[model samples]
Target chain A: MSLFTQSISPETLSVATLARIESQGGIDPFASPSHPPRVSAPSFRLPARAISAITLLALIALWWLAAQYKIVSPVFLPGPEAVFRKFITVARDGFVDATLFQHLLISLGRVFAALAATLLIGVPVGLLIGLSTVGRGVFDPLLEFLRPLPPLAYLPLVVIWFGIGEPSKVLVIGLAMLAPIALSTAAGVRAVNEERIRAARALGASRLRTVLHVTIPSALPQIFTGLRIALGAGWSTLVAAELVAATRGLGFMIQSAAQFLVTDVVLVGIFTIALVAFALEWAIRTLDRRLVPWSGRD
Target chain B: MSLLELDHVSVRYQNAVRDAVADASLRLSSGDFLVLTGRSGCGKTTLLNVAAGFVSPSSGMARVDGQPIAAPGADRAVVFQSDALFPWASVRENVAFALRMKGVPRRERDRRADALLARVKLSGFGDKPVWELSGGMRQRVGLARALAAEPRFLLMDEPLGALDALTRERMQTLLLDIWAESGTGILMVTHGIEEALLLGTEVIVMTPNPDTGQQGRITRRIPVSFGRRYRAGEPVRAIRADPAFAAARAELADAIFEGELQ
Candidate 1:
């Protein structure tokens, strides 16, 4: 009966009958549909992003509930409203001699500076390792030695060598970033399609030109992947980096607030760090889409 | 010497194995259409690679213009089975790659690239990315990119092996047209027996050893003239319709699978 209302059947399914059915306003002469066909949403589908958003909402609600009921001391886990108010206060009134924006800017500067350093040093070193057997022999062990060492593990060493200066903080962050960039670049270079190199060489590109035009361009996607990983590494290393006598940074602010038992300010600092990292990640993903749109399309 | 020659060439890899190619030889001259066909494991591609200067013969000679072919060069451009175009570039930029390497001026190279794109029947597609094109179109772009070098010989490793049958037939015609117009010698490797007969003035059936099935060598060189007939203004369909084309195709297929068991 439902099939008759819809007017799709073995008779109607034929091409010759399909035209006749289309000519008439009534899909079925015997029974008209209760309403016109509604294009309903696709069934049994939940967007992954919506799931994450819901989880975040739940966590925030749980935080609010715990704070409202006074299940934990205010010093430990403040209400979202209190943290939000503190965030506003810091954004406007400043915290521990520097405002929230100033601390964020300072940390951003360090991360960017470290990133630039990594690019300058890592790309060439990676190219050497990828292209030269001797370079692989020389640098492979050194990189492997350094790559797994936690930023905290090397903090004392950096401080001892560089004397707790701004360079020391940047250097520690750069060290954390270096291996990802260099290794990813090496992998990218090594994974370049052999046929592309041959095609370029046959087109009369010199060895140097081939590397410059073919190898580097082909590896751009992977290099960008490395940069994203480096950003995450450098961001995580920020707190450790600032522990070296830093006066103005989110890490320093968080530590200073923690010592004073200013839970709201500490929460503010942590939230800002996470928010900024999220923003930077989104920005990088957008830029990657724009620049290397051809990366995995084929 | 022919424009390109492989004389008694054999190639052995570094590790424990038989020679990948054992004692194979062939010649290609200007405007000549030569095809290498065989079953898999027969090293037909290895022979084409030697001719392209991508691989050197371990014991014998691979030469162009009587000069020992040492590395991949402009004289013998190669089209791979995989259309290995740079994704970072537009189609025009890819086609102009050879001219760019030669330090050709910007305007001149762009014009030449456009001309080559037209030759490959892909007009007005210069600004498109390689990934945006279909398989056959990408293959055509690869052909245009190679032809930009104006190579004396074109070596291909099953350039049409990836396309559907209809696209393959169209490309076969396009390849012949380019050969007739440019006078570039061609050496191609393919698994298609009819394709070899349809496109080759001369076809070499490379055979793997019956005993070991590892060492590959040339067993028969069958000369055909279908590509030449098409080049000389005969219609493609009519040429294929000829009784001789069918006879030659059967014979080529027999030669390719000769040493293998029934």
Candidate 2:
């Protein structure tokens, strides 16, 4: 008898082979590699966290030394302490007659509003494109045209169309965020396994039920990936949007501070944007782990 | 009365010059186990798909209970070779999916799913994710899911094609037991000659159409009674080891080979 047939039960052999394949970083036996893996129960990685913190502190120290030693002019590169002081000042006295929180909130509000709109409109449109040839014919060319154009390239047109107001700013950011969400959702829908769809149909699922229950759930991981990408794109576009026209927002605050050569305030704005963006990504990643736990494992 | 029937069916895909399935007719009544055996591209699957209502016949008709098959419905369930259980759902939930789709209440669906799982020898495995199951277990789950729909006719396309020899034997026995207990008509397509003789109440041998040079036409229909012996109280292993069984299997194999040569 073959070794596979001789020693152990076939079930055990198959399970062992699957585990071996998984250990080798082969395709997951349970989930597709494209989907997210189930999250393991939370465990503290204090050593890794310490190392990350140390690296950040070391970079900040190097920046401080370079500024203090005048290796780069303080006017161009403010020290971390200077930025910290500016943060306090901005919190107390405000910038451009708006408090720091107000600026932060306004920028946040714009990006989030755009994100919400993208999810609402882009997801359905993307699903349509992914599921049906007619939907693809209708929207593919339009999205293709929009996707490659940089947000700034269309900023002038947006301002002209919507005027230099909240609508214009929101519109630009929304447009910037829309493509990834739609594209990813479409990709996700298309990526749904043919067998799964067939199984659903065999189980007496209507076309609508198959799309809703099978297609939507299968496409969720890719959609989450798109959401992450769109959030980043939207944040970057917020700066450009504010630069064009905005009375409030961190983007406006930084641009206005740059005119006065207030390098400290500019640095603070940049750091705050980075921090918020990082937090947003982390939150989404955590949610993805919880929501689509069946993604990348076998 | 036939549970499912295909009358002189031919399936020709658009833009294809010849039919995939040509002038093939089949009937499956309750408690009947019909196995269609042929080599690849013989259009056995296309015929199955036609009967399942996934594909409409280009020229002829497929019906269930005298009603024309327009599309896929709950009356006919398919078990695929891939064991396409939903990875996102737990074992119970996967089995319960058909019930849920049919608007069965949650409590009843769970009860039916659990009972089906037990019938398939997967009791207490309800909460386990499908991906974690072995190939045989997955196929069992797939079978349970198919049964959950309470289908009148079970159509399988190479359902045990992926399993190892031992697992395949085990699955064959399991299939027999399920068939005896459920009494649902089964129409399965496979390439294995021995599998056909061993499991089938009637074996239909398909070959390329001699006249049209198309993909498939039924060449022979052989009635088998050995499987009923197992139902009549003989052990499967003894039945398999019997000389009569071996003779039947060899005859079927030679017949299929002769068709291939022709």
Candidate 3:
């Protein structure tokens, strides 16, 4: 039979058959009717907010029960109320010499600075490596070598080279963010659909124009994924960097609190870090939706 | 002078034992619709790529307006089998891409894009993202994008091979309409025998030559009069249903299968 005229058998056209098809993840043959259909509210999957809220409440309840019953010892795992009290105290007075907000700002500033530096330097180098064999040959070995090494492995060297100041801390975090951003960008560029490139070239686009319009845009979805990963890496590296160095960030606050047996303060620091990391991830995802809306669709 | 000429062009990839396209010659002038038809692995697409400057010929030359095509240029545009539309761009921007590359003002390019979109019967779809379009509609957008360049020669590599049969038939009619209106020379590659007869002013059947140790060469060249007859305002269904059209299609199909057997 011609592809256009082929039809489902009569046995396959029943409501039961249609339901079976739908159950099997095939299209709902009865979704659209030939005549006016019944106007009914469409059903949807469970809302993500509800699921998250339930999970969060359950975890908090478990934590409260554990502390109330002394299951794990309050000294080691503080209750949610204790953490909340600690948060209020830190917000009102201070942690160490700086206020909670000040410590957060300092950590955030370091991460953002490192991220900005990473993007500025990494994106262009990544594109160059992606576009040119020579660039790849020159940089691939070094990037590969540095990428596998843990950021903390070279912390001593970084401190010795740049001194245990802001620059050294920033350098370590920036280095941590660098590999993911550069590698992902390069992969994105390399993974640009060959057909799109051909289409652009055939449409009379110059090499530079093709790279700007087609290559970069095509690579963007993957690049954003890389950025999200890099942000996570930078955040973790910031904590590591601050753990060994000066005294103004969340990491330093958490470390000093532990030394003084201030478990509630450490809990506050952990929650703050978790919340901020979550916010950064959400922001990147929102940006991805706005900028490259077509990324994952096709 | 011909708009596109391939004089005994041969393309062979590195480390390949035989030429992908072996000493094939063809010409496309304004108002010409040349179709290449063959079975799988016949290298029809390779030949089309050679004409489009995507693939370099190992011997002989492929030229446009008597100038050897060293690299892809604005003078020739290609409609790939896959629509290849930029999924991120709206239909208007995708169609206006060539003009935008030339640094044309946004207003003028959008205007041109609208006109081209209308020509492809996608008048109100200019704002839609390419991913939203169906396969046939995407191909139409691809055609509009190719035409936006105002190329002297339009090349296609199995442009409708992905569509449903009904959509393919509609697209064939649309393609003929565009060719009739634009008067641009076309060199299209296809595997459908009936499609070749229905679309081409001249149809060439390609086949791999085992004896000659060559991969692809033209086995037959048949000048078609039916497309001209159809273009002269005859009812499309009537023309397609005619005995002459059926005979020609069958003859071409037989020749292709026979070449395959050889």
**iRMSD, all candidates:** 0.8, 1.4, 0.9
- Model 1 Cα displacement at A123 (Å)? 1.7
User: Residue B200 in candidate 1 has what lDDT?
Assistant: 90
**DockQ computed for model 1 against the true two-chain complex using alpha carbons:** 0.63
Model 3: runs farther than 4 Å from truth? A1-62, A69-73, B210-214
Q: Write the per-residue lDDT of candidate 1 for residues B111-223, one digit (tens) a residue.
A: 99999999898999999988999999999999999999989889899999999999999999999888888888899999888888888989998899888776899999998
Which CAPRI level is candidate 3?
Answer: medium
Candidate 1: segments with Cα more than 4 A from true spot: A1-46
List model 3 lDDT by residue over A71-139, tens digit each: 998999999998999899998899899889999999999999999999998898889889999989987
Lowest summed lDDT across 10 adjacent residues in model 2 chain A is found at A1-10
DockQ, per model, reads 0.63, 0.49, 0.65
lDDT of 3 by residue, B1-262 (tens): 3578999988889999888888899989999999998877788999988888889999998888888988887778999988889998999999999999888999999999999999999999999999899999999999999999998989999999999999999999999999999899999999888888888999998987756545888999999977788789987788889999988988898777764564
**lDDT, candidates in the order shown:** 0.86, 0.85, 0.85
Which has the higher DockQ value, candidate number 1 or candidate number 2? 1
Model 1, residue A26: what's the lDDT?
32
Candidate 2 per-residue lDDT, tens place, A1-298, comes to: 1111111222433443354345447874667565466588867657777898999999999999999999999999988888898899898889999888899999999999889988999999999999899999999888878877777888999888888988888888899777777887898898888877878898999999999889998888778777777787788777888988688999999999999999898888888888888888778778977887777663
